[model samples]
Target: MSDATQNDERSQGVSRRGFVAGTGAVLGAAAIGGLGLPAQASAAEAATAASIDNGARVPVLIIGTGYGGSVTALRLAQAGVDVHMVEMGMAWDTPGSDGKIFAHTTKPDGRSFWLRTKTKQPLSNFLGFPIDQDIPKYTGILDAEEFSGITVYQGRGVGGGSLVNGGMAVTPKRENFSSVLPSVDVDEMYNTYYPRANAGLGVTNVDQRWWESANCYQYARVGRKHAERSGFPFVFVPNVYDWEYMKAEEAGTVPKSAVAGEILYGNNYGKKSLQKTYIAQAKATGKVTISTLHKVTSVSPAASGGGYTVAIDQINTSGDTVATKTVTADRVFFAAGSVGTTKLLVRLKATGALPNLSSEVGKGWGENGNVMCGRANHMWDATGKVQSSIPTAGIDNWAAGGAFAEVAPLPTGIETYASFYLSITKNPHRAEFTYNAATGKVDLNWQTAWKQDSINMAKSIFDKINKKEGTIYRTDLFGTYKIWGDHLTYHPLGGVVLNKATDNYGRLNGYQGLYVMDGSLIPGNATVNPFVTITALAERNIDKIITADLGR
Candidate 1:
């Protein structure tokens, strides 16, 4: 490995100037190739969907412009088929009141945040509203009334969860993938879809020089030393951010900062949200059309050949009156993440709007047993900013017959001294979501049956970290140890799952034209970031649909 690569492995923080200078040195050759495609496309050009067949209307209408939705749109458009996408959030533009292009934290004032207000009885914010409000609205998936105490951050702009999620791009361990998708050939899927998705999204490891100065790296080093002392191995994580930008930060060409630490809030810089990736490429195809701020209310069986008619409520940007529009499509793909897809399908099933819905519309929910842990160091060294770079290492104990654990650097900002942290503890948790018949809302009732496994995993990893001779500081227990039935990371999976609700290929089990391609199609928690999996599955499903022997 090069010095920069060695530095990254060692967990060194890089300055912004160092980052930029390193990027210029390393990326100059690669940038000369096709790297200019994304930059050549303006923000507007990147966000707009490409045009499909001009002679005929599209055969498919994808709802939501998220990871799954955008991927499906891109594949279909590439196949020369017409595709239209409807999104409930606004297009990503200049930063609004916050002075940032994206938002990571919720504003106290309701003006900037998104809330759920779709029902007569106004829901509370804890259930999942960005801001507390009494008005009836569709506040993403969480029950705003019940989750009032929790901060459930769901992105409402063009890219959906991709805009707000940590850019951690990890493939699930082989066992996890096999358990959830036993029928599909895991090796084939990985070989085919994994590289395709990564290429499309620009996945790369953090430049070593950047990690040389990053606070996250310092923390990782601490964790690694502790793990070594405890006989545990240190693992590096791969992410979906522009490593070039990271190098720029290290070289001081760019600001020694990130889109901002509220990664789950939103990244104004550094991170590559879907809006900047698949969505951007799909728009470049000139065949997809995306209508933002338009929410789909219902879908019904069209009188035509196994098609469907979608009812959407278009929210006026300037006024209160909502206009409804009915659009027809030969196929409808639901790629609105896990919660959004499940809620939509559940509501439709309950209301008899799409009576042919299968019995397994809403069930088998899992959270990939997500737990965030960290260790605090006593030293007061000025490590580089944490948010500007991504984690470069991970632990594979969980994947290799050992407890599931992955450690990475946590960006706690400068000045505050801290060591490495891990979003570790990767045992798949079994949870279920129930639709309340009386209220027409989905309630997530999670039980901690896998508590022992999770605790064991944490203890083993912590012990390993502590045993490392080079370790600094003790592993300090921080947030989210209680494992309450609280809302955690937004990587929700299952519910409207595959094989059961849909056919082996994601076609609705009973309905002819209905399809689902979002995280919901994932049979279980990924134990890693879910976006790449979701996108790859979307591609796989679209390919199966287009190649089917069924006459078009």
Candidate 2:
């Protein structure tokens, strides 16, 4: 398809203006035009028309424009609160000369950095390439030698991890959530937020009829057979791709899109990332002003008011850092994911920028014990192409008192290509986060028991799979044996957990105008994709803050 034709096709059903209006109205309470106000505002102006007498200072300033940050911003804005969003990545939708979107990792090798340089196709940041040799590489937050034994993938642009993560919108089982957070009501939370999240992100189930195709059906059949032989049942997985787009592809109106296949490389055709969803709407609010490429360096009590002064370093497109600006805000929400927020808070606490930070800022870190494993049938062709779309089924072994494992249909769906990957939940492993006195870098050191309880759970589930129709083989490991290797999760959580240092609702216990609302608030492993949960919890926390007018 010609570039112009493809662009037109993508924009066919939705206009830029319509998309923004719908998003803002649905997600936030602020009139679309109210988000552009400065940090300080009169109480009368900040309150929603319905609650004008509440007379509160705008309750939030969200940092990072990822899932949690985006949702929080939209909700607060919708409530008629003035919100300012700061991010370190440039906006997508607008493309460079090569028609590439900068969502993924940039390589040092020019050949791999630009999509035009390698595939001659339009690239979105969601589909990342290896860092080229010429680009400077940092050791980053995670320790490479301790986990996975490979370099980890992290997105540095606008949408954060959402840009490059598998667009699977799987919710954790209720038991899993209760196991880690016994106090929260999972059912009520799910009911309140799941639908909201789905609507905002345009989530839908892949059509079962579409799965009947050779590519989707064969592997699904294999999964069913294995489940029957092993005393397990296959359950369909919910995803976040546009079903209309899928239908168009099936009708031959669109090319074979990212649906029914792996989405990590980036789904040019399916899956909705935040940059296209919430961020776009936040901009339309006209009340919300986003400054991309502005990295927050420090935050402290404001000199002239009862709020905070945020020090930021603004970098230009050429990677030149210049001009430090101190922006003041009445309230601040830290949604910089688990790692980002934890790192910043740790530095602030150690350096005395925010000395009242609780001791729990860097504890209770867990990796959800993620271990990606898969098995192939003996008669199956091992080299056939695997399906690239998200997996549609999962084994509810966890509910039955076993391990967590989901079977995804491979991209090609041929018999030989048929492979089912499993994310085995492990016994909780505890990691500690500490700061280097000299380098100012945070350090994470984790240790776990060799015969952890979660491993035993995985083995029981694997035995059932082995008893079924397929010959089992595991590609990813936990520690050493197929049972021991620890898979690093895209969903890293805890560390600066809620209640430990902050209050039950994420407000810093003794501090004023400080709050955390991201993955860091999740106390431990959730045993599934955590984006939905993170966003939901953030929404809940923001509601409490606004209701109480805590910071104002």
Query: What's the TM-score of each model vs. the native?
Result: 0.76, 0.75
lDDT of 1 at 12: 25
Global CA lDDT of candidate 2, please?
0.57
Stretches of model 1 off by over 4 angstroms after superposition: 1-58, 97-99, 104-113, 116-153, 213-216, 256-262, 303-306, 316-321, 380-389, 399-414, 419-428, 448-453, 463-487, 549-552
Query: 41 in model 2: Cα distance from truth in Å?
Result: 36
lDDT tens per residue, model 2, 373-484: 4553544333234344556666667766556676654442222333455554655666767777898777776554522555566666766675444344433212223433
Error of 1 at 497 (Å): 1.9
Clashes (candidate 1): 72
lDDT of 2 at 83: 82
116-229 in candidate 1: lDDT tens per residue?
A: 332111111211211222322222212222332222345676788777566788777666687767767787778898778888777887666656655445655655555565
By summed lDDT, the worst window of 10 consecutive residues in model 1 runs over: 119-128
| Model 2 spans > 4 angstroms off | 1-60, 96-152, 214-217, 259-262, 316-320, 381-386, 409-420, 424-426, 448-456, 470-487, 550-552
